[model samples]
Target chain A: MILDGKALSNQLDVNMKAEVAELKATGLSPKLVVIIVGHDPASQIYVHNKHRKAIKLGIESIIERREADFTEAELLQLIDQYNCDDSVHGILVQLPLPKHIDEGKIIRAIDVHKDVDGFSPESVGKLFNNSHEHYPVSCTPKGIMTMLSHYHIDPKGQHAVIVGDSNIVGRPMGALLLNAGATVTYTHILTENLSAHTKTADILIVATGVAHLIKAADIKPGATVIDVGMDRDENGKLVGDVDYDHAKDVAGAITPVPGGVGPMTITTLMQQTIELAKVADHRTLQPVR
Target chain B: MILDGKALSNQLDVNMKAEVAELKATGLSPKLVVIIVGHDPASQIYVHNKHRKAIKLGIESIIERREADFTEAELLQLIDQYNCDDSVHGILVQLPLPKHIDEGKIIRAIDVHKDVDGFSPESVGKLFNNSHEHYPVSCTPKGIMTMLSHYHIDPKGQHAVIVGDSNIVGRPMGALLLNAGATVTYTHILTENLSAHTKTADILIVATGVAHLIKAADIKPGATVIDVGMDRDENGKLVGDVDYDHAKDVAGAITPVPGGVGPMTITTLMQQTIELAKVADHRTLQPVR
Candidate 1:
């Protein structure tokens, strides 16, 4: 069975749009401010897509763009301005900032409450510790969880193998699975006998950005495969970490490259923006003693 | 080969003691404050042991005992007092606090700077992210890493299986090993065929708190096993999660229950206390803008 993320994302959006209207009716506008430094072409496209999504969902989206030569101090000051604005519910700084800027420093500058991208150390800590409290996580991993739940694929008592060690997707993805009761194995570039470990997984998540790193032979038959890779093939076609065309024949369920994880990520981001706004509103509604 | 955590801890302490003296000579006295609420017998003994270890190393130790009826607000106030104190380098609130006090709230109340036990979300987040910044981690897992380093058990490219999912030990242990370039698998009570996972481990860490949970048959020959469980067997004798008597023959190296992880934990706590003191002192010494 193919896990059609595009269809699920569209399905989820209908409800989200209605929810946003209700929130606005209650005098709370769900607002997201995405700050992008530099003129990276890919980042421009990503920022545009997020803006379009937010507009469709009836949430306020602001794209703050800076030149490639923007000073780190200037970027931090801009973030601080939005952070102090109670009107903004979510703050996202596009990653891979200019060479002069420190990515970690920029990430740490965002308020944890408005940390829409959930890259802050505090949010990451809460996710890894499986805190019972509501906390935002990296959009990709949290989106994957939503996909899994929609498909009724429970990770309990399963062996989930994460084929990357990235802070963005693989690490948090494994933590989410582990919290969901899956015995999770994390393998990275330095891992030895990678196939030996991959073949044991009941649920395999490949986010290595290595095209065709996992062939059909590397997969366990009947395993649920979620591919999080966006790599260019020799022919300039987009491909996933797994050889999906062949692996899908052996795997019980799978997600395709373009339509699978991509749409869900944007959808999850919009959902999180609205959720954060509601949480902010709730906090204000609480009566002071 | 026995990992000999007790001997290693004593060996490390000689250097730590001298380091403490050197710091004191430089006009900085490392101070640790431990707060324990209610009289849980095990917690009392653990706190006492920590206090004793700190004093022996020439570091200042203060124990704050609270009655069972102490309110959560009072506990938070106490933590805030220590958090604001410049003289105090570390603040440890003993775990398994009275049911009335919320553990998470109290942990967050501790100044991340003085989070000696490393239970704060910020510290935990740093551990998982493998941050380059200096941060303390849960002592038991940190101690295991120290022992592994001393015994030359490099986890790089090795398959390390964690047989429990406790936040304090198993989760952080896996993250530490992952940061060290190991392929780490985390298994817990819900894991299917736990032995199947354990047998594949080049290094196995068991902390299920279930006596004799792992036997020789569950181990792979020549695998290094670290047992973190402190359990009481049917005969009222202290034992670990692993059946060490027989499993030791199959294992290449292992840590014994009493003389192993326990001693190293206290030693690591002391080491971290001093480290936090130095960091605090360094922050204060930085030139003002």
Candidate 2:
């Protein structure tokens, strides 16, 4: 069965709507500040979608538009402003910012409580320490688990192999899978005999934007596959790192590009927004164990 | 060959003492603050050993003696007092503080910069995130790696099965091994068929304080075993988690309980103290790493 992220996100949106309505009744709507640097077409599309989603969920989202060449000083200035803004419940700066600005610097600049992207070392550290007191998990990966559950993929005791070592997708992905009780292996280019590890994985997640890096032969039969890549293949069409056309035949479950993980990324973001709103309201969304 | 940590720690002090001389040439001595909160005889003995080691190496040592019934406010106040004191390079509040004090609360109070025990959630989180900035690693696992290298027992590409899940030993040990390019399987009480994982490990580190928990029957022949357990067997003799008499006959290398992990634990704290002091001077120490 395919993991329907759009369906999951829709269901999640309804729950968030109720949460936002409750916050509205208290005369304080959840507010989010999204800073997008540059005129990147993809970033524009993302910001627009996020704004629309927040509005539909009764959230107040203020988009702080900045130039592609925004100075580090300017970017941090906006972040400091958001950090102090009582009106801003969450803060996210669109990633892949211009090369001049240290992405980590800006990410860490946001107060730990306000960093919704969860990329700050402080935020990432909390996830590691299991002290996530109001920590916002990365939307894409959190969405991956949500999608996995939607398709009923219980990772417990399974061998989960992630074919990337990126801090964003690979490392945290391994941590998440490990937390779920899966025997996790983080494989990278440095790892000798990559196929030897991949073929044994009960769940295979490929996030290296190297197009067609993972094919049907790289996966175990009846394994679950998650593709978290967006890159162009030889045909110049957006394809995942996986050779999905044939992989679907061998895999028990899979996520498709554009429809699978795409919708859930922002959907998880909005959900975190509502969750953060509840936290700011001095109410607990889930009891701390 | 027993991977003797007592011998290793002694050898390390000789090496680190020479490094400390160089460090003193620059007019700064690696300093450690050993805080004991109770009159626990065992804790007193451990603190005394650490204090003696630090003095022998030309390192500055401060023993902050506090009563068993100290108030939470007073303990936190002591922690805060050290947070500002520049002479204090490392802070170690002895474990198992009196019952009235919440260990978790006290653990959080230690400044992450001076958290030599590396038990603070911040340090643990940073270790988990693979970010090694200004954070002290937990001592015992660092000592385990030191023992591995001193004995030429490199864990790279090997399967490491650690039997225990305590924050002090098993969990961080798994993270440390994985960071060094090993396939680590962390087993706790909930893990089914404990020996199944242990038997496959090329290197096994048994840290569950249960005496004689691991026997020769549970380990693969020629596997390296590092016993972190310091429990007394039924006969009232000190023994490690592994039964040495049976284990030594089969295992390629093992560490004895009395002379194994115990000595290195204090040595690691001293090494980190020197390392942190050098770090403060914009230099890095190469002896341990």
Candidate 3:
């Protein structure tokens, strides 16, 4: 069975649209400010899609675009402006800034309350510790968890292998799985005998950008496979890390490349934006004696 | 081969003691403040041991004893006092606080600069993210990493299985190994066929606190095992999570219950206290024109 993320994302958007209308009725506008520095082509497409989704869901989306030569100080000043604005519920600075800009400093500059991208150290810490609090996580991993829940694929007592050690996806993804009671193994580029580990997984999550890294023989029969890769083949066709055409025959369930994780990530971002807005309003809307 | 954490700790202390003396000569007195709020016998012993170790290393140690009935507000006030003091380099609140006191609040109350115990969310985030910046970590796991490095048991390209899920030990231990380039697996009570996972580990770290939870048959021959449990056996004797009497024979190298991880924990605490003091002083000790 294929995990249809695009269909699920559309279904979720309908509910979110109603949620946004209700929130606005209560005088709370769910607003997100995305600050993108430089004109990286891929990042531009991502920003465009997010803005389109927010408008469709009735959420306020603001894209603050700057030139490639924008100073790090200027970017930080812009972030401070949105951070101090009570109406802005979420603030996200698109990553891979210019060489002159320090990414870590820029990430740390955003207020934790408005950290919708959930790339801040505080959010990462909360996720890893499995803190019993409402904290945002990297959208890709969080969206995968949502898809798993929708499909009733319980990770409890299962051996889940994460094939990548990226801070955004693989590390947080493993932590979420571990918190859900799955025995999670994290393998990276330095890992030895990758196939030996992947074959033992009851659930396999492949996030490495390497094209078709895991073949059909590397998969465990009946395992739930989640491919997070959006790599291009030699012929310039987009594909996942797993050889899905053959691995799908052996795997019990899987997510495809373009229509699977991509839509869900944007959907999760919008969901978190609305959630943060409600939380922010709740603090201010407290009844006084 | 035995991983003699006691010997390595004593060896490390010789160098730390000298380092402390040199800092003191430079008008910087490295000091640690440990606060114990209740009469938990185990916590008392742990606190006493830490104090003794600090004094022996030529570092100033202060013990703040409070009544079991002390209010959480009073405890917070005491932490604030230390947090404001420039003389204090590290603040530690012994765990298992009174039923009325909130542990998370207390942990966060300590200034991150003086968080010697490294329980703050920021430090944990840094550890998980493999941040390049210098940061303290939970003493136990940090101690294990020191032991691994001292013994030349490089974790790179190895499969390391952690058989517990406690925030202090198992979780951070896996993160440390993952940062060291090892493939890390985290297993807990909900893990099915736990032995099946342990058998594949090149480096197995067991900290479940369950007496004799892992036996010789459960281990892989020639695997390096580090047992972090401090459990009492059926006979009321000190033991570890692993059945060391028989399992030691199957393991290629292992750490014993009393002399292994135990000594190293105190050693790492003292090491970090001095390091934090130096870091704190470095920021204030700038040269003027």
DockQ values for all predictions? Answer: 0.82, 0.35, 0.80
Model 2: per-residue Cα lDDT over A1-289, one tens digit each:
6766778888988988887888789776888999999988988999999999999988998999998888999998889988898878899998789999987677778887777777776566555555636577788877888788777788877877888767777777766666676766667665666777788778898988899898899889999999988889788999888888999898889888757788888888887777776777787677321
lDDT tens per residue, model 3, B1-289: 8999999999999999998899989898999999999899999999999999999999999999998999999999999999999999999999999999999888989999999987888888888888877788999999999999899999999999999998989998999999989999999999999999999989999998899999999899999999999999989999999999999999999999989999999999998898899788774331210
The fnat of each candidate, in order, is: 0.75, 0.22, 0.73
Q: Write down the RMSD of candidate 2 (Cα, Å).
A: 3.2
TM-score for chain B of each model, two decimals:
0.97, 0.95, 0.97
Q: Is candidate 2 or candidate 3 better by lDDT?
A: 3
Query: Which residue pairs does candidate 3 place in steric collision?
Result: none
State the lDDT of candidate 2 residue by residue for B1-289, as single tens digits: 9777877788889988998898788788778888898799888999999999999998999999988788988999998998888888888889888888888788878777788888876677667666646667889998998889888887777877888766788778877887787766666665556786688778898988899999899999999998999898788989889999999998888898799888999899898888778776778656334
Q: Considering only N, C-alpha and C atoms within 3 Å, which residue pairs clash in candidate 1?
A: none
Residue A253, model 1: Cα distance from true site in angstroms:
0.5
User: Candidate 2: where is the Cα deviation over 4 Å?
Assistant: A39-45, A149-159, A180-182, A193-204, A210-223, A242-252, B39-41, B151-158, B193-196, B212-223, B243-253, B281-289
What does candidate 1's lDDT look like per residue over A168-215, in tens digits?
A: 999999999998999999999999889999999999999999999999
Query: Per-residue lDDT tens digits of candidate 3, residues A1-289?
Result: 9999999999999999998998889788999999899999999999999999999999999999999999988998999999899999999888789899999888889998899988888888888888876778889999999999899999999999999999999999999999999999999999988999999999999999999999999999999999999999999999999999999999999998888888999999998898789778773331100
Off by over 4 Å in 1: A283-289, B283-289
Per-residue lDDT of A104 in model 3: 83
Collision pairs in model 2:
none
Clashes of each: 0, 0, 0
Please say which candidate is ahead in TM-score: 1 or 2. 1
Candidate 2 chain B has its poorest 10 consecutive residues by lDDT at: B280-289
Model number with the top lDDT: 1
